[model samples]
Target: MVTLGQLTKKVEFLEKRVKQIMKMLQMVPIVAPWEWES
Candidate 1:
């Protein structure tokens, strides 16, 4: 049985992980497919 508190904690953890991933992506120079064609 999953509790509300546990679910909230898991959501918060996932949000933090997503933010970290976004930061990492910003640091990298990722080119778009359209740019590649140009």
Candidate 2:
């Protein structure tokens, strides 16, 4: 039985992690977009 508060906290934590991952994801493209240009 997950409470609303607990669900909210989990969602927030996941959102934060996703944002961090997105920032990291951007680096790969910026660093090597040319790798796939061929």
Candidate 3:
């Protein structure tokens, strides 16, 4: 059985990773919005 503490820790880790990825994405430039449609 998973304890509440374990679930909280997992959620925190995921939130941290998402924040890091968001920061990296912000540094990238958007050259095309629909380039993949072709």
Highest lDDT: give the candidate number: 1
Query: Clashes in model 1: which pairs?
Result: none
Q: Kindly indicate the candidate among 2 and 3 with the higher TM-score.
A: 3
Give one digit per residue, the lDDT tens place, for model 1 in 1-38.
99999999999999999999999999999999889988
- List candidate 2 segments past 4 Å from native: 30-38
The lDDT of model 2 is 0.90
Model 3, range 1-38, lDDT digits (tens) per residue?
A: 99999999999999999999999988997558688677
Alpha-carbon deviation at 4 in model 2, angstroms: 0.3
Looking at model 2, report the run of 10 residues with the lowest lDDT sum: 28-37
Decreasing lDDT order of the candidates: 1, 3, 2
Q: lDDT by residue for model 2 over 1-38, one digit each (tens)?
A: 99999999999999999999999988875656677777
Per-model TM values vs. the true structure? 0.80, 0.73, 0.77
lDDT of 3 at 5: 100
The per-prediction tally of clashing pairs is 0, 0, 0
Evaluated against the true structure, the overall lDDT of model 3 is 0.92
lDDT of each: 0.98, 0.90, 0.92
